[model samples]
Target: MQQQPPTSPDVSSAAKSPLFQSSTQYRNWRFSVEQLKATRAALNQASVAAIRNTFESDSPGSSSDVHFLDANEEHLLVKLYIIKISQLCGHFRFPEEVEATGITYLKRFYLKNTVMDWHPKNVMLTALYLATKTTNHPISLESYTANIPRTNASDVLDLEFLVAQSLAFEFAVWHAHRALWGIWLDIQDLPQAPPHEELQRIHDTAMQHIRTSRLTDVELIYPPSQIALACLSLAHPEIAAFWARSKNADTALEAIESIKRTITRDGDTPSVDVVREIDRHLKICKNPEKVVGSKAYLAKRAREEKEAELKRKKKAENVRKATEQGNPFGEVLVGQANLDDDD
Candidate 1:
């Protein structure tokens, strides 16, 4: 039997409203830790099989010595590209929505597609460009790509549809910053609320935590409000406790701590040395079909062309035989008009 769909990383303690239950994010993208690992491992295995096939077809024994990247290594390279997405957002002065959504898109794309077929560098650029539009921070195609050293409009535009498709066209994202704003407002109206300066400090710190949480899987496994609450918990436990008690402490705290553990455990970026080694191996083992001018690609192309030529010749010969046998489709002789015309 097929494996059961992955459950959420943590069973969310908070309740969901009808509206949230209807959302694509709620219905589609969430995954447990083991599920995510299994998904990546399966994708890596399929890609490695294809890579080996390509090499074996091109020249026997070539793939026997190539070192293929494992699932964890693929993730490290994607992580390196995730950092680059942040720098692109900063350079363009984009809001947090664009940055966060861009990062999410890049991550989700790799979930559906392996990096060996499409490198994250190209996909990251396209994901950010798609993010600018999906988040309502549109930039013209020309202006969007003008600053990059060797990039043009097509470079990003070509991959836009691919990235969107991989995301299942779920462009609406409920970000943590928005949820934090709601909490920030609610905190001020509480009875005997903290001083304005202290509240502001707390919100700022919570915002920092929210940003860090973007690098983790908390967003996928939890809703925005829960993630915001968790960020608040990280920023100041007492304030978070007060806010939770003012609302409903039991359910809120459970979610807050669950998110906290995930954020704290997996929030760090992977080491560059690890990623660099993986990228080096990637060059050697990437699918040859995607590499233009590679031996496998050229051989595959030549075979296709030869097949097309033979098919064309076969079609023409059949037509010639049909005409020679006086089929209705035979060419008309110029000198012999229709027999009926002689009357």
Candidate 2:
């Protein structure tokens, strides 16, 4: 009797959990465009309002002025911080799985708190510490903070619980690495397959794409399987075509397109000027006293202060014109009085 081919396992029962539904349904990890917009807007508004209030309350013509990172600046700073997280993980000799998980934790945490409210450096350290524990590659707090500059055990441990709370203790992160392995295995079983070296190259290239993909919003928008397919598509078009045709070609193609858009949006690579600006701002944010003394910070602050002064003068001029028009509501128009108050 001839041996029979093994049947695929029935995963119907496993489809009932939230993990299975993550690709189709919106989970806590996923964010809509509007949600991202609102979050950034709220952070910017709060920072500006705080700065204005401080300037107004302080003594007249004080040189001290507050500076907050704009949306673009904040985004760049976060990207740099994520890169630092990878470096730190590498220094400790942790596997890529730990690095990916840690970076995801940092990203998700920032979605809840702004860079102003929670410094990215501390959060990055906390996330990595959490990742090491979660991945079963536990490291002592002392050992972890040994080489990291300006950090101690307390810095990591103190924020560890907060980071966990920010993530709602959602430690389970499904990475595209495993999915890439599955695709490689499938390719190996195919007839007329390439030599082992070529197959390894395909696998390596796909892994590289997956690593780069983490620097994008694709992880939040798409599932690991889609990410895996997209990476393979970038690596080997034939493998991607085969994989898509075997599954839902339309859906897979759409996801691949979205990933392509994200990669394009990130651009070929960050320009040197952009990278320098990010570093300058990151240094100021981390060590304001040291960096605020720099000439660049002073020039930037002067420009911002000038803009704020212009806005104030314009507002005053508008109020004066409104009052001269003999409008009873002119005082309220200048935001000086409330019209709703009973006399």
Candidate 3:
């Protein structure tokens, strides 16, 4: 008999080990982080290329009217979007594994699906529902539907099947929050220490940026850890520069030097002093809702009721037509009606 070759351990077993997992997982992740090395890079590159192109081509002079939210506005909306998505992911009955998987799903889905086409809330619900099913998290349709925000709840239920089928049942995901904690702890033990205050800021800001990774195509190609690192690298510049400098004092300036190169290459890096400008922009968006009075809220509700009435009437007409033609179950409808009342 010929000599038998050795059998390797299963992939799942290796994944169970801490050491073999992180690097392997990071390397396997998608999209380039370097694409949006700075705030401006997103404007010119694929980061927001779809929206920018749409506005620019649709009407040559209308780019100004399209309202490209400044970096601060972008950051705020993206951060808020992530929080809601995270909350929805938490509703799933899965363990930490499934929640992590859902976050990745949100990131990947938004990379291609914009806030313009699919509101973040709807997408968030859809991703979580899909994730729960993919991981076999034991959530029932009724339970899931009940937990959704009352506004877009039905729309989410409507698209639940499509999102799940599109994801192809891969529900496993890794998260940056854990990885950021790991990196923070790892850096603390280094021979040359990083400042505690700086590390905390970096961690917080990185988490914020990671939330927006969903707004970019980068999610599909990169691992959560790398996304965290990229965000950290961008958010907390001094820490990264210090680490790079300490590695080779002769090239102590190398880390900072590389940042300069990154800026030059990207051509979209915000000016060196963008933090103040970003802060101002955030204040404007967060100021106040225009509909503050009880009357305004009531009016909004009435408008929504009227819209719903119109939809109901249209649906009745369609259903009557279908029945007259010998169709049943109203099964021919393929589009999801936008129920914007929830937002």
Candidate 4:
């Protein structure tokens, strides 16, 4: 027999490296700082344009109009929705990974489409549904929608495909939870590691920080490993020394500090009244009924639909007329000539 080539490395080790790789190929979810800024800018611009269009159409000469939600307010609305997503995940008894993935999807979806066009309530549920499927924690549409008030299977399922398409089908989310675990193991291997109980405290605190970090833009601007290290630093001051010893200590510390500031700045949850107001707006967007100006909006939409129907009928009539003028291929191709015929 011919001599065999050099044996390849074991499959286990081969898989391990890729699992930890933070490069673009392994971690497509990672984005540059500029990209994050651009996403926010685009969302703001679209929102302003949409609001202006609505105002212009409603009152053509009104020059004293303001945006419905300024940038800060819009950001607050997004945070509130993420909180709602977490609550839903908890109610369903889903794991932390599912919650993180769902929140990630919700954030990503908003980057491309504003709340005006796509209501976050429906998108939140759809994101959770998609997250469950992607993470191998499958839940049926019926079961998922049963507990959600004023929602049904179609509400979630109908938007599932659209959400996936919006994300470009890149569903591989590397959450900070895994990085937290990896850091914990690294500490365990250190020569001067803390006691088991202390280590557990650190781990639990870091996990909590990771959960809170989900409400910020840290996920989009920083890698999961950095986020995990940052959380660990916050949980245990000693971890700062470990980060300081790393090759990219300066950069890593900057990112960690940045994330810490975000966490600190937004530590206080929105008040119940604020949350209720945001929820009311989201509900109105989802179902315009019972809301002010809904009647005018509905009437305008009806007129537009009627106009569209007339245009469609006129196009069909033109096609029919063309096909009847001795054009052998036109009849079959344009007019469904053989659609009703049976061999």
The lDDT leader among the candidates is 1
Off by over 4 Å in 4: 1-38, 58-67, 243-251, 275-343
Off by over 4 Å in 1: 1-16, 298-343
lDDT by residue for model 3 (36-113), tens: 334234532443455545444534654454434453444334445555666666554456556656666765554443
Better of 1 and 4 by lDDT: 1
Cα deviation at 328, candidate 4, in Å, is 13
Of candidates 3 and 1, the better by lDDT: 1
Say which candidate scores most in TM-score: 1
The order by descending TM-score is: 1, 4, 2, 3
Model 3, runs deviating above 4 Å: 5-103, 110-121, 132-143, 151-157, 194-202, 221-223, 242-343
Positional deviation of residue 54's Cα in model 4 after best superposition, in angstroms: 3.8
In terms of TM-score, which candidate is stronger, 2 or 3?
2
lDDT of 1 by residue, 13-78 (tens): 544455676788788888877888899999999999998998898789999999998888888788
**Over the stretch 1-343, how does candidate 4's per-residue lDDT look in tens digits?**
8997888856766676665474532465556667776777777777666655655565674424342554455567777889999899889999998999999999888877677557677788899899999999997787777788899888898888999988879887888888889878878777667899988988999999988999888888777888888888889867645644543466677667877887767655677787667656554333232233775467667888899888878877866886777676654664565454332
Instruction: Tell me each candidate's RMSD, in Å, in order.
Output: 10.9, 15.4, 12.3, 6.0
Report the error of model 3 at residue 51, Å.
19
- How many clashing residue pairs appear in each of the predictions shown? 0, 0, 6, 0
Task: Compute the lDDT for candidate 2.
Answer: 0.73
Q: For residues 15-97, write the lDDT of model 2, one tens digit per residue.
A: 66656466322456766556776776777667546544444444344324434567666666677778888788778889988
True-structure RMSD for candidate 4: 6.0
Ranking by lDDT: 1, 4, 2, 3
Misplaced by over 4 Å in model 2 are: 1-18, 22-26, 50-65, 248-250, 267-343
Candidate 4 residue 71 Cα shift, in angstroms, is 2.0
